[model samples]
Target: MENFNPDFLEEENDDLYEHFTFTVGKGQSPLRIDKYVMGKIENATRNKIQTAAKNGGILVNDVPVKSNYKVRPLDIIRVLFTHPPHENLLVGEDIPLDVVYEDDEVLVVNKPAGMVVHPGHGNYSGTLINAIIYRFDNLPNNSSDRPGLVHRIDKDTSGLLVIAKTEHAMSHLSMQFAEKTSEREYVALVWGNVETDEGTVEGNIGRHPKNRLQNTVFLDDEADKGKPAVTHYKVLERFGYVTLVSCKLETGRTHQIRVHMKHIGHTLFNDERYGGDAILKGTTFTKYKQFVENCFKVLPRQALHAKTLGFKHPKTGEFMRFNSEIPEDMQQCIEKWRNYSKYQELEE
Candidate 1:
């Protein structure tokens, strides 16, 4: 690797790019090369980063390294981002979106379940970001092409989302989310009956110690501690074993609803990561248990959904609210509960 100024790496580009170099920071050792690069680069997808590493785009101390190579202290890392293939990159598909409202400054859409917000990891195309890119000609040229994304819901979580069309709108909307002035609500069918009607779970959430793919609550104070998160939930209906609850997020954290509910002993139905299996076992209805197990075979992700979003419009200064009905899979879960009640009556 030549003596390239790191400052040149920050230059804006509308075309292909070359290799960029960065140094491994202290206490940042023992991370996979791809994972390390993902943390270092803003808005770069993991798959793209990994692809670059595999093709000799990433080098350590002037020697090419694999994606899985672990980093040591003071390692010189270089990443070359080759322009992605035209088909693999995010492009506007002519997919019809349920646009709830649209204006010059902002747009609101009822984001469907199973649509990822942005390209990442295994998902590189057919995302909401791609759709927005297709719909609008001039997108904000920020770190990512997703200019107006104020916040995001999980891929399998369906709900209302606001997109800012202008840079000013994006800035104000992002500020609202940071200040916790925006209202976000979700409806989830959690395993196990919530003993309390309404309660708040306050904790710090960070990456899980053992599981690299999941987040966990950290109770103790640490140097690089997790951010403070609070969630208030109220049980809407109880099915003797499982319960339908409405969750209000005061602080947005990754997997906030799913993890916080689990931390309080009621994990979401069919959530594979936390304590979902225990709920399947505790239900009195054996048939229902078998049904849930079978459903898990088909439903690979968690059964949590974002149902409502409320925020003040950045440009118009008007309060905006949007709501979406639960998706079919979640509705099926509720139907199973109803059938469980019928089965119990027949048994009696």
Candidate 2:
């Protein structure tokens, strides 16, 4: 939670790379700010915290402070740091894009599954950024310096994405996301029949203590361990072994939907990264097992789609919403489940 959020658009897309605020306990003893930070946050290095202080990334009661600053009781501490540079070497590539809507300030594209939003790490090319930069010019760069992207969706998730063509548009679009005024709806096929027709999942999401590759839910006493995240789900359809659900995001923590869905005991169908790929549900009948496996082959990735996206027009202040068709894989998988459910009910 790689760069962006909205489950988090991966973490690279999170609004800020790092922003932490903590209150010193009443009984807390005096300690160096850097050292205190290292203790409170996992994987934080002394050198890093010191560097952050040097960069004025550390604050005490709204004032920038040095690493040597002594923490006292009731002190308000804030830490801010951007993630390491990414999309730095992005170059325009002549990749085709499914552009849905475009204007002087904004562009909406229906991004297909398997396409990275921007370049980073192993994926240095063939991203939506590469494609858009090829077609468009002088697109605005956000605080992270990635041009045109205001938000992002996962590589395996198919759906609509809005692009900012001007700096004014960028700021406006980003503000909407941060303020939760924008609307995003995702459809997912998850294991288990969710008991409630609609429900809200309120939990703090943070990186797993042991599994750095995944996010976990922390609640109640441990809520502060992670970032606050909220997901609202409504049952769309039900299969004997799985359920199709529509999820709305209130906060875009990294892997928010994936982690929250898993936490509620209904991991997304075929979400391998979150342990939804295996046969988490279904029966022991050899025929049924084979049927499920065939469905998996039909839809090899997580059964999630960014079906609807709505946001205010950055320049005109007009609210706009875009809808996209489910990808072939997910649609086929859902149909298979529909038939399977129909036959299973007849047998019962």
Candidate 3:
């Protein structure tokens, strides 16, 4: 709500690309997405922009738009390319990976916090993809030319991910995700106490027009502007000021859990971009503020983790399920909150 860290947000890359973002000027005339982009960047032809749009790299307000989509005033547009601004290719780095499961067809990895899933413009190295390329050989490239990648988690969120090693494996895994047959579950610490033990939040999610870095739920007639997303959550613990919840996602839209929880008045704890850094539900006391600050220092990023992943084996047709533990930072933060809630101390 105040300031956003763009560098952190850009760390989550669905594809390895250099993304250029634009905010339409108030005085600018309305134009198609392709023509508008061509005018803004030199050496960018309309056809080239159209091609990028066809590839779903043209985003308006975080929603993929076609080349003919009209760009309105104040729309946030992001144009992405497979290469960097300087056209440098991706390089592999020898980053250590926490391989939970691996075989000839697939590999399941527990990705740590602060690690990017793939390379981007400003982030071209030290990504999980880079590590995969370095550690393995002959990984079939996806449509984006990213090898061994089927899906990705956020940069700050610790999680389990399944990587495909062969073309047949990639196709099988991607189809499972596309048909919503895969199962993904997350553990999130959110602000406030969730009244219900379990519930579902279904909404269309898109970019916030004013805040380009954040996404919001689009409802009513505006729901068509965004894509359908569904998240079902249940309370795990009540920490007074914060609640720990387990979320199962039916749809995997970008920032689905974060925005959906916030829509229901339970933003993920310590989610800086979503206003969870502030004390949203705690007492107005110096001690409470200091306690929360200590928790924030313990876990600097959003309190969300992809705890479980289940899917059919790409090659063998056997169902496989994987789960990861909560990272140290999040575990320590939860302990601190648990102690605070047990004592019920609010005075300075």
List TM-scores for all candidates, in order: 0.76, 0.77, 0.78
Per-residue accuracy of model 1 over 179-209 as CA lDDT, tens digit each: 9999988998887778899999989987675
RMSD of each: 5.2, 8.9, 9.9
Indicate which candidate wins on TM-score. Answer: 3
lDDT of 1: 0.76
- Give candidate 3's total backbone clashes: 0
Best of the two (1, 3) by lDDT: 3
lDDT of each: 0.76, 0.85, 0.85
Q: Estimate the TM-score for candidate 1.
A: 0.76
Q: lDDT by residue for model 3 over 108-178, one digit each (tens)?
A: 99999999898864577889988988888888887667888888888899999999988899999998988
**Candidate 2: global Cα-lDDT?**
0.85
